[model samples]
Target: MFSNPFTPIFGGKPDVFFGRDKILELFELAMFERGSDERLMFITGTRGFGKTALLEQMSIRAMKKRKVIDLGPDDTVEQFITELCGYDEVVKTVSPQANLNILGVGGGVSGGSISKAKHIGREKLQPLLLDFCSKNKQGLLVTIDEIQKVSLEDVSSICNAFQMASRKGYDIMFAAAGLPYSYDKIVQHTGCSYLRRSVHEEIGLFTWDEASDALNEMFSGIKGLQIDQSYLDEINKFSYGHPYIMQLLGYHLILCINENKPKARHTVSEVELKKAEQNTLLAYQHRALKPLLDEFSGQERKYLMKMSECLDSNRLTATSDIAKALGTTQNKLSKVRETLIAHGIIAAPERGKVMFCVPYLADYVKQEAVNSSVISVARQRGV
Candidate 1:
């Protein structure tokens, strides 16, 4: 019923961005400071952890000092060169030599256009990238989101280009972001060794104070929008500092509040909040939790299920207890525990204990198991 300021969709820039000042400070210093190793950084986090949103923020800052090109899964360096060649900054310098101008005039582009980008480390991309860095006073910044989904073909070319640029001291910088395991997977490929040595920062959950400030500032900024401090605390508990979940919860809460009070002029009611919580959980389960669960191995998932079963009131579960529930020894579950921790799915916050980093994961896993059991029983009875 209200125009929601929160962006619940993945990779969207919310109206009021939450805290990432620490990371942004480093990014700014790297952007402006020469010989700073943080220039090429990688942000790693699980799904819905706001890797893409952070990249968006970096690009905003990057544009002031560098030419920013943000790429998604479908984008390629060939398309990049084609576009970059015609851009005002580059066209003035390289337009005559670039094939982009030739294609539109009397002559169409030759097969070399495709062939050039396909095979790099030769003379295709590296040359143009070097040229751009040379001609433009402000360097070029390339940010790739969902790096895991980016093709090896494209990744190699970009890596080779930037590697050359970095060695030559040309003003060039690149940043990538993806799932927690994405770095491990990509670096194994040939010519990606630089990523292994580059700055890698793991994006984690929002701290309580950060979430609190974001909630208060976001709500107070909206005209005639008021949520009681108690409900805000409830929201903090529900969201548990996960970025995307917070956005979804805020959006649905605002919606329910608007529906309950016409003109959005009153403090929200308990009934409205109850409905909003339900909507938030359902949306989080489908949009975030499901995809995350789908990525894990069977043993890892079983570990999570058993761990959820043994979770204490504080949401902390003992590894030994989970191992017992799984009919395995504590030693055998160590690998599974570490795997989840490495993926940012779980954390061993205390000695011999683990907790779900994402909120409602325990409940979602239990509910998913119940749904699967219901389907299995229905199939057996042919109902």
Candidate 2:
């Protein structure tokens, strides 16, 4: 069985391991220097790059000296405040008031979900957090995961809550993690003017050596398992060191080893492992990639196809070359860059370098382009 060493190392935050040491170190430094203006550290990364795992790790670290409130994605301000105020505890601890102004259950109020979150505003939520911090009398760390899913109004309220708690001598801190664009999304949503004073951190991929070591460490923990360096190198190459892929490959290798018992000396055969990896990758591509392709428009699909063709040269393309390949103006391509980014298809790593977020999709695109060309040649011959 694949023991999932990353789970224990990351504490089941999901998609958060294999890399991100520098960011983690900086985060700890920020926490140590708590009460500074940069108490709110927003960690951002691509999908499956382990943003949640980092937050869960932080939550575990904070649990030693602070209280943790795991905020859901769609929680309203009222719901948030109630949770923050320990409403569950209050109903169980304090007066038996049956007439509490609950928003949803039994329809006690007259506001929609958005309205409900806005209702708490800065005033109501602020006091509850302040009181909680005052009573706890220890460092309070409110780590919000998937914070991007929360509405702009709610995000603003969260930023405001941090500001209010900090001003009141409350040893409170905030750590939020989300996608690469989440920081800008928060800033745009929360225009509370205080966010400008917060710190930001970006978590990126692992280096080749780091990724190799991680795979070795991960495999060594599994009982009756001993993978050779050659097999490990092949797995790393196929996975591109993506954390989720690393886990998925690890999971499948264990299954293969257990099944192919004849050749299961100490490690599984690479040939069977490759087949299993292909199957797993196909399933993932079906689930994630096909849907994204279906959502693309004719022009967008063309642009992506061009990107694949250009990137497959194993070389990066300039915007001008990308424009020529797509037969579109650079301005039009520029306009759609944000859309492609939002759709999570491609990313510009540096100012001038662009590549597919999922390299397999680029491969798929290349195959499809070849198929289309072959079909065109057949039609020409028939004519």
Q: Of the candidates shown, which would achieve the greatest lDDT relative to the real structure?
A: 1
Q: Give the Cα-based TM-score of candidate 2 against the true structure.
A: 0.80
Give the per-residue lDDT of model 1 (tens digit) for 63-149.
877789888877576556654554344424433335543323433344333333322222467888777778887788888888888
Q: lDDT of candidate 1?
A: 0.80
How well does each candidate superpose onto the true structure, as a TM-score? Answer: 0.84, 0.80
lDDT of each: 0.80, 0.67
Return the top candidate by TM-score: 1
Position 214, candidate 2: lDDT: 85
Instruction: Score candidate 2 by lDDT.
Output: 0.67
Clashes of each: 0, 3
lDDT of 2 by residue, 1-383 (tens): 34434332222455425556666666566566765544677877766667788787777767776777767677656566766754344434323333333333332332222232223333567777877787887677777777778777777777788777777767777777776667776775545556666677766566678789888877776667677888889888887877766776776666665565543236567776887688668755665466657777877777777877776455565667688887778888886777777645677776755778764787777666787899999999995
lDDT of 1 at 332: 90
